[model samples]
Target chain A: MNLRRTTTATALLAAALASVAAPGWSDTLRLQGYYDYVDLQLGLQLPTVVVPGEPTPFGLFAENAGPGTADYPVLLLSGGNNMQIEGVSGCTSLELPQRTCALAPLVANWAHVLRFRFHLEPFSRGIVVFGAALTSEAVDTNPGNELQVVSIPIVAEAETRVAFVDVVPETLVDGRLAWTVRVDNDGPSAAISPFVYNASWAYGGLVDVQCTSNGTASCPDQMNYLGPGSGWNIRLVAPPLSVDNPEIQVGYGVQPQEASNAFDNDGVWLVYRDAFFRDGFE
Target chain B: MAAVEGLMRGPRGLASFARAFGAACGGPLPALAAMLILQCHATTAPWSFVVMVVLALPAWWRDDGARLSLVDASALAIALAFAVSGLGPGWRFDGANAVPVAGFVALVLLARHARQGDAARVVALLAVVALLQLVPALVAYTRTGDPSLALRDAAVPWLVVPNDLAWMACAWPWWIALARERAGATRIAIVALLALQLVAFVLFGSRIAIAAAAVGTGYALLRDARGRWIGAGALGLAAAATFALGKGVASLEARMELWRAAWSLFVANPVFGLGAHGFVAGYREWMPAIPVDPRVTPWPHSLPLELLAQWGVVGFVAVALALVASWRSARGRRGRYALAPVAIAFALVACVEASAMRLWVWMFAALLLAWPRLDEGQEGTEAP
Candidate 1:
């Protein structure tokens, strides 16, 4: 009995030592399953600009939040077959052995989540459904969590044109100054993220905005999108500027890599609103 | 003078210092040549730094002593040439190059301090490191059916290959030293360890490295005359099999085109060649039969051809001389064996990898095969 115990222990030790000796072996032994199955969850990342007829980048991210390793029984991306996976090289004789073709295979864990980005094809403007799912052969604990769909409503536009619509003077800085500058986006398509406008004053300048606000009420510096003809009143607060010119340079052209006409994109204006310093009063 | 003194001080005065320093510390050369064979990358690699500080630096700081014959003057010259070229048009230099050069220098410094018992210690230390690396490799394998199959994890390009190969090389001297000492169980363990590393490396699909390892392994077994014949025959068989199996066809065709391109570059400036690191520029102008719509690569993939093309015969001779010098230094039983991995890796690197661009590749021949150390009851027979 003693010898048997000793022998067993020795073999175990040898096996353990052997396992430990290999580079990546020890990490495997800690896993609970014989082999894990992936439980995949998918989501979408909207691009900077989603025009109705123009090409734009849109990404779909899949996460496997499971202890199990996942191999694709099926990976489906709905945009029909014309949507080419952007960076994928040509398929070899079974680069992935599991399926005839898969978006990606062996999506083991969250670390190796499968992602696909495509030039979102031009379809009729409406809520465009970009849906993706990964059905793993591995035992998924939450089977319902497999499929994900992101339906982004693509707003229909007239002939594509966006420009600085209107900049209205709201308030004047009294003591430690405060005022509201209304910036509007007139567009066939919405102005995304960076709404860059130039504010130049003649005598005393307005610089250093306190904060930006929209929808609710707060000081506005940045904006999400300028829905066609709808504008956000961005209030500006400043300490003081050396170039104290009271004139505010209204709206500049849309700052894109390439634009059709720069002249139509930008418009200039002078502040008609009275400031305490311009009035030379309290 | 101070630089020379620093390299030598780790051993003794110039001559003995040269001998002791040049002799193999083993691991770094092959590792640099091949890259990491899937292992605990962070852990296995960091041990070198620890070994440097603990083992090498103290001895060097005290002006310790030893003996030698190897040098990489040609490598140095080529690197200098490349550095000059890298500085061309603009200072377009490879930043990560210093890593390999540093790895090379570290091997030299460590070998200078090596003793008889140090082999066992290094082997043991490296076994741990290799095992740690293997842990990641295995986990990776388990998750993804193929072992070598992983996303492109290049914090640095081809960084992992040489480091792993060096660590893998570390096991060799230990294997030899252990065998020489007749340390039975330990030898088995080391063998098992190496097998594991090789399996992981293969699954990683670094086909070039796999070939290099095979070459290195053949050299390892070729200690005696009988073993030599066996090794040679096996290598020939491997070559024959590679062709017979049709595996070599694609590689051969690719290499032929690369060699042609390289040839074109060489013919253009036969003497001085295209002023070191000028292969790509030359390729664009010369544009030999491009296979797979071949774009300009830094290396033509074949080491000898690349050398011939870029540095001309002069640069090529410098490398050949360096190898010869290293061989001369690490001659005899273990020295020969130790140099095997270095030689094979270089040969493999020549055929496949851009090892010349990575100065550390040269360091293998420079550092692993020979080094200077005190005659501390250790025979200078063993190789890195």
Candidate 2:
């Protein structure tokens, strides 16, 4: 009787110690109901606003929140309009609209990250809604978490509409002849790396070249760029008011190589004589 | 004798004084701190956390000589779970379960020795806080002429998510119960406070909160003969309000996406959750493909989902056990009558909002478990 009691007590103590020592094992022992549930969760990260026809990169962040390991976890990426899969990383299949990644065996409390690159066809405007779903060997108790759906707004290609807006003559503090050459960016987007290149010129080169804009009192970085509905003014001191070269002809055009409305992109301004001439005796 | 007396006059005396002060203040402090936290939008201040630690200290000073009840055990388990989950790689003591765990501990200490009067004082204070919150809210409403905008503007320099204030106000039923026990001026005052809370609720315009309040208050009041009509009216009004605000289908969709993200987090670590504020960091990895702003909804929005996502299955079990224990402890006729509304209100709010990690919310839950029976005779007496 004494021996039996001792054995019983010793066994109970060992079991209790084991339960306390290994939490995972104890959890499994206590709740066998969820032993087979493989909760594979799939998520995707991509830029919400993307330029069409450009190679855009996105990533798949996958996790197996499981009490059970997922031996065959597959990621299904699809439901995107006008999206073409240019390249993929960590995925097995290259199928359009519905690409599958047969991930490695994902045990409980483990994660797998995969990346992909795709391009949206040009002229694809409005919103594009895409979805990704996860499937594994074991059952996901909550299907709501296993799938992710996201929307991206496709923005049209940025058009830099750079055009010359009338030049005005002004007298400087030193009584020097100056012309304010105004340029307007009547754009629906921003002017990237915009510049007033001297396409053609005559007589002496421009002196005291200072730039200003409506956005700021002075141009930011030599008028490197202009926002939509903004104006940039390049103030040039009139060349030395000489009789030998009576007219200062300045020709310039704004660039992006191409403009949505290129008609007024370049303008030629002829300052006959000088501000002294324009004042009365032209 | 001289040496002992000298020692008493020194640091030891100060220590004793502090302990006495902490013990004396512990019962009302949780309620007071919760009130301030709920009313004030800024929680980054260290005062609330300091109060929690001070309140919890007295539990270690003198033995209350009371055996640990199932409710007490479960509550302690919750704190332990929170603390344990906070451990591991890059574990910092700040920003996760620190305050909540301290809150749970202090709640346990408060419960061990709190009397009916203490409970009453806490409830009364909470009601007063609710009334005070109404003033600014009303002023904003008068200016904005829109309840939602009013609530938002009133909480200037401090962002008040509509759901947060609405969740806090879910305790209106408890205030109503307290008012029923009063007479004349006190009763009228409590009634007036409830009215203000109702107005504040309307101004806040959180559909989830409105629905939770309606369910909790309606259930509590509909049982009484005098309050039956009022309860029915309230239920009708709440239903109508929810329906009217049902145009927020986008909000609901956003919540669904948030829930999905939380679910993904849970699946990633099913047994031991990501630990306190883990979802805040991890959800980015599992963000839904939708063009949803993560900053707008930092929390999972669902308490159960958050628990699963952050604390994992272990934390979830601890909470489940605590709920069972609370139900058992408050199953008596009078206890049920007193505790049911608060419990129901909080539970309903928890279903749709991240109320679990909030210190005030935990304090309210503690109040639910610690509240004394109304028939225990006058205010200040300890339960036999």
Candidate 3:
């Protein structure tokens, strides 16, 4: 496998060297009054939409549609102010704030591609336009085909972390189970929509559900939008009978409308039950 | 010239037969090439390339080289510009790169062929290709029973999207006007074809397409001195209709933001500009908060601005020179006025869509470059 990889790399290097050494030759089959033509077409490939805080891969491609070589070709990088661009392979910085991916002379029917990855700002939203241009010393036959622009729509996003707090009962014989479910908006942005949660008991009815912020008042079925770094806690109480090994499950989920980047905390829950109280042993 | 004339006379048997066959097939050959381009599933457009090479074979054999006029030279320059834009960083090749070069080559061949043969017949054949786009629409309608779906989604898997389909519709009125002196039955058929095109234009719901049709048709009407008022009325009606049906100012606002972003890219490099890929990156930095259609993002959505933004002034000059030269070359031709509406509609639509790179656009350009001169006495009267 290593040998094959080495062979492929060697072939590519040789080709690149050959292209740099002899970029183009004047056409011998030119019709009368026809000057040598060099047509270069530029293209780009990237996902149209991207999530904030994630690396997005993109490629810029250029091809010489020529009867001659494109001389002194340079690929210029522009735009993407909302993104942190990285892994810009095969390019050199020619000017401050303007990185140019310079290439050797590109012969007829040959193409060059520059692949890179860009990460959107953690709290960024709206569209991000990435632009690359192919400029050469020679006048191109078709300029419209020489510049590529790719737009990536980076959506407004946030992350919500759910924490389960288990509290010891006052006494084992009390037959009481209590736990707290806390949700924090560990976000780059505010959650703009509601986060809905449900409290269900398998063998015992939910005795009481209280919002700690409201001093033991009933908790709403859904929590309103929370700003970045904000949190909410829901405390649940249930009673266990000796004959019944009761269990309590507090499930929660956030809709996509909540500015959430990922669904990691979606449709998740924690279960609580007391075995000693169920068996009447303590 | 003498050598070619002698060769033509000397070929008396099989070679003569082959030349005759080639000549017979030549008029419809470009249309066949276009059909291949439209039908090809892959972006490479390999089959169309083969057909173009084959279509140009007769012209090559005749050796009756057409003069490379200023218009042709400018067009070639534009093609070169397109080619050089593809020369970037790493050595690679793909369909996106190959198809455009092939398209430009096909444009050259078609121009040469049109200069030598009946240009009108080739156009009629193109009309035939356009009409054939409806077959799939019919099949879609049969399966789903929804005209909108048939026009928009159904044809996509098999042929063009609704926007391209609408672009094709822009040609109907011009073709109908060109065939005005035909027989009664043929005129009726042409009318029916025009109706179908209008239906496609309306049902496809491509705002750009509808506007293009309005402008193109309105222009044709306005040119006829007697119908000037009608043209004005038509434009007003179209505006009213758009407001009533469209998503209104919001969509227009989106396009405005996109154009502003593109203009910023153009200003950043007024000379060579950023290469094609500069728009997306530049747009984010310059106009980060603007909302735009994900489908139309990165593209200026306006052809002229896209050219300026990507290729800068040099690219704009190349295209402008070609347009002026083509206009000059096409002067004095019979029914040259018929081209006005088509050109107007095409330009207007391109202002809201990146249609400059489409194969059909190139084909239209080739036709214009090859448009017959008046002195040639080759104006066709056949109905489409």
Candidate 4:
């Protein structure tokens, strides 16, 4: 028994040495998953003006209330609202000739939030986040009343949060290969309805979308659209999934806008808000 | 006369003093010169610095105690020609990256001395220097497992063909020479080490290196034959086998791809091809868009193709003339020295695998020209 024990120890030592000598063999490996959150802001400003026969440079118009006297109402235009004539006052009835007058305000302010979501794969290295903010300028404002111009600063930020998970491989009795991947979104925000798709050799072959989100009956269907807010336990099958041979890609975004297809093999994508324009509505 | 006298007298007068001074400082001059030129142009200076440092020890060791040989003189002339031609109209000095040319000059001078038996000390010094590179390389490999592979990926990021090929071509000759010099237990040990390196090369999966080794070894083995009929018959059989199985070889397939690309470049600019460093920029104009790593530029990759793209047929002819001249001048065991040009020529042809063709070709040409004349009576003293 002692001899056998010695032999086993020697064999283990030799294996360790062999692994060290050979290239690309390692022990005590760690696979990490991460989630990145990004915040972005967009805004705009316009110049103020008044109307004469048209709108004036400062939105200040002169009107005779009574016999050569005039009055102007102080108007504050703010936040995405269009300019309009308020009212005329402060004139005697006999001093000035009767005149029809109006006051038009310039400049408007508007703000909206655009959210983009993405998931980090296990064991991936050096992932990067890229995005842009888009906006449009308004043309043809109210005559005599110019818009106040405000410089809109575009804001962008990215933060990476990492977590580790256990991967268990399984062989199905029906000659299929499958694996249950436990992906934890270590970030403050839950990964939300995350589903693994477009699996490749890098990610250990084809992975079919399996049941997720608390194992409910609707989990598989709903998990296809992920990122509501929770870690995902997904099971995937292979072979048939290898036809398109698509690369492994995970995507997420805010309400209304769904994540687009993975940009490329590197799993990169860009997101931004659509442009806004003013019609005739007040 | 005064200047010459001063040179002979001032701290430089003593042979030992001059030798020590040169040892201490002369080795870095080429790199320093390169750095200055690079700095003047406002290009990246670090690459030039690294390349210069890499070339310095080899250059110094080669030139230390040696005299200029015919081969060295000819190489120097060629390098000078390139440098001069580079200064011509349409060639912007700022971007030409003249350090490689400068390094070529240093190597030529070193080769001349090596031919004269004056470079023994330099060779010894260089052996130490080359050995030092093994430290970091080995450490990196130990940490990451494959240093060269990692470096190649980090540096180039996209194509793997040329980097692997150039490394194999550069090291194979040295390995063969080292193997030839060893005996018994030591020989076995050396061979084992060489095998490990070769295995590493294979792991790089470079088709170019594998093919170059096969062709180079075949040429070496076929240099001499007992009878014309037997030799002819053997050649015919070999040719048939090669034709039948060449495509099965991955290296050959890669070479064919490179050749096709090169041929296209030649056809497009049959005249004075693209400008220096122009091939990478021009690849998009000629080739279809392939998903390429953002880090790697589209370089022609083959030496001949690079020449054809950059210098046109004229530059190619100049290179050919230089190679032929060196080949004709080499004497003694012509077969062995012949390997120098053949290796270089094959490497040039295989440029799609590496960017060292110009450097290797010039180095081989210098060695060829500086090869000690058999009549010089120093033949017996030549170190392996």
Interface RMSD, every prediction, one decimal place: 20.1, 16.3, 18.9, 24.4
Score every model by TM-score: 0.45, 0.51, 0.52, 0.41
- Each model's lDDT comes to 0.45, 0.58, 0.56, 0.36
Clash pairs (backbone) in predicted model 2: A65-B267, A65-B268, A149-B290, A150-B289, A150-B290, A151-B290
Off by over 4 Å in 1: A1-282, B1-55, B64-79, B87-91, B117-130, B145-181, B205-210, B219-248, B266-290, B293-298, B306-318, B331-345, B357-363, B369-377, B380-384
Chain A: TM-score in each model = 0.34, 0.45, 0.51, 0.24
Docking class of 1: incorrect
Residue B155 displacement (Å), model 3 = 5.6
True contacts kept of each: 0.00, 0.00, 0.00, 0.00
Per-candidate count of clashing residue pairs (backbone under 3 Å): 65, 6, 47, 50
Residue A30 Cα positional deviation in candidate 3, in Å, after optimal superposition: 32
| Runs in model 2 lying further than 4 Å from the true structure | A1-282, B1-45, B52-62, B86-97, B136-159, B284-287, B291-296, B372-384
Q: Candidate 2's residue-wise lDDT over A79-113, tens digit each?
A: 47677764366665545545666777788778888
lDDT of 4 at A166: 24
Q: What is the C-alpha lDDT profile of model 4 across A1-282, one tens digit per residue?
A: 343223222322332333234222110000000000001122222122111112212122222111101122122223121122222231111111122222222122222221212222321122222222221111011011122334222111111221212232355776445545444333222233333343323232444556454865346445433232344454555432232332333222122111431211112121211233335434
Q: For residues B79-190, what per-residue lDDT tens digits would candidate 3 score against the true structure? A: 5565444342211232333344344434543454444334445555656666666666757766766654464334332233456655564664556565664668767877
For each candidate, what is chain B's TM-score?
0.65, 0.78, 0.79, 0.60
